[model samples]
Target: FKDATVWTSEEEGILVHTDVLIKNGKIAKIGKNLWAAGATIVNATGKHLTAGIIDEHTHIAALSINESGQNSSAEVKMEDVVDPEHIGIYRNLAGGVTSAQLLHGSANPIGGQSAILKLKWGANADELIYKNSPKFIKFALGENVKQSNWNSYSRFPQTRMGVEQTFINYFQRAKEYDLKKKNGEEYRHDEELETLAEIINGERFISCHSYVQSEINMLMKVAEKFDFKINTFTHILEGYKVADKMAAHGVGASTFSDWWAYKYEVNDAIPYNAAIMQSQGITVAINSDDAEMSRRLNQEAAKTVKYGGMTELEAWKMVTINPAKLLHIDERVGSIKEGKDADLVLWSANPLSVYAKAEKTLIDGAVYFDLEKDKQQREAIKKEKALLINLMLQEKDKGSPTQEPKKKDQEQLHCDSL
Candidate 1:
């Protein structure tokens, strides 16, 4: 039962006093005060129950966010490098996050692949993956790759043209590599280019890091030349200029809420970027490139109202459905509908409010986080730690040191005394 504000997929929005029945990790039924036999019911009466928030772009849980040693480093996978116990995962879940696209950093021209992850707290890495998630590559543009922040004296692709060329060069190599592999040419294995070749063959999609109009157009041309589409552009600060082109190219754009002026290339970024892109029929999503912004994703969606006058539901879609669509996991996790995995959150007040708190978070029919349980867990952890520390100190005061290591050292010394 989604207790707070229940948002059902039906035309009616935020049904009050609703009872939702969940069975076998799927919503069985929804009605006001509905009774079900043998079903575990959740009383989410004062919570805002809706689809779990999806963070379209983030670097949380990565061993390293960047692989900048080479221009193209697509061999690396975020899954292989995830740190499941990152505090950010728990924090995001507390903010109603259920899934995230853990992306590689934009330190290189062609970065590694991104992994779509469900925020299954307390689960191992394998259990956290969204089953059958689509494959995606990370292609970066503008200052991050050009080394504009640092001295560009020794870096490859120092100019915008060089960045475009780097992309093109890689695609060309990938195309040939793919052709050889397909024809059974028995060529030496190259992991990096193997991933690029997947993009060339339309087996994987590209999510580019973009800013500035010229570079945006350049990346699109490179994608077109390689006979594959650029799926989405993350942080497309100059997207307003090429919104129509992005729409025509069938490329989605995931962008910041109102970020600007953090760098020289992003000086022209306007708050209405999302609205402008959406106006041109481009599928747009608001993302948290920063860790802190990810928690209050509802507020990020609200910025569209101030900037472009988007409806509340439309704005909410930017953080929910649109991101799920871009990640190609829409069918499973984006909305509160019957038959979808029951990944949802219940909030204490209007989710967009700064004061709102997620009362409960559920994933795959299991209550993963409950506010009250979390509070108790925190207190228990503190008490346990304090007790353990005191016990260690007591042993120390009694002159009973950790004896295993010392015993080993003494035994070695005694043997040497022979």
Candidate 2:
């Protein structure tokens, strides 16, 4: 049990100075200075506790983010290629991220499906999965998919129209594939299109990589024609221009903070994309496409205040509730509420400040990161590993047959795979 000034990510300016009780890894209760006689209590009098941040789009665990061999390669699953020991997960947990949607990159017109991972620090890859999480696919547009500015040998999708046709062709093939599978046709297995058929049947949602308004509108129409929806448009640099259309399509936007002009297609990218999308009643989320950017999501949310005059709470929602809703995991997380998973972060100061730090990060009522303890643990691990390695080398010098060194592959599911 712990007592803190909780910021539930509910109503604006609403902070509850209460005790949060945890039992069996779930939030047991939240009330005013409550007591539990035999339970351990940690006083959080000055810290601000809020739900752990969720990264809507990330590619941290995969061995390769881009499967650009073909334009529409939906057969691959990010889960199959997850590198459970990626050090990036630990860094993200230190930054207060508890959940992340590990997405495929925007290299193909229709990329692969994404994996919703829970940052269970020190857990195995299978354990990191958010069980029963909603399914989503990655589709891409603009220069990345079109290969307009990049000198690449990839075939097809070299133009905007080609990109749209690539998506249409994949869906059309997927629809027929679904019918064939339903009818028990002996179709030679094609893993790529099999995943796309799921999307056409509304089994999986789409998170597109888009920029220009033309491609944005095109993808929406394609989804509309198929009677399926593009769930969210990631890195929608030009989303401000088509906020109304996106709102009508019920598509959310996850974009970077003031990142623009890196490519010719992003000439019109604006810092106010998130705010404009919100103004049009379209769900908007500020995302960190880069590793460093994710650590300061609070500041990314603050950008809405500077560029679009959005209220602080609204900006906060862009990172918290709005992202959870978009990912279809709102019921379990994204807010510090009773009966929800006890995934929370305690901030030392106003989280929006550049200097703010995550004092502690908890997932399922277990402390995943403690800055001071991490430093100590790291040093201990370094010493132990050095000692063991030295012993192994000495044994090898003595020509001991039993001293054959173990390979890296034998490190069974170590933690920090978060």
Report lDDT (CA) for all predictions. 0.82, 0.80
What is the lDDT, from 0 to 100, of the residue 310 in candidate 2?
Answer: 86
Error of 1 at 198 (Å): 1.2
Task: Please give each candidate's TM-score.
Answer: 0.89, 0.88
lDDT (10s digit) by residue, model 2, range 204-321: 8888878889889999999999888889998898999989999998899998779998768888998988888889988888887666666678888878889899886777777877
Per-residue lDDT for 23-49 in model 1, tens only?
898877777777778876676767667
Candidate 1 TM-score versus the reference: 0.89
Collision pairs in model 2 = 75-191, 75-192, 122-415, 122-416
* Cand. 2 Cα-lDDT: 0.80
Error of 2 at 140 (Å): 0.4
Query: Alpha carbon lDDT of residue 36, candidate 1?
Result: 75
Give RMSD to native, each candidate: 7.7, 5.0
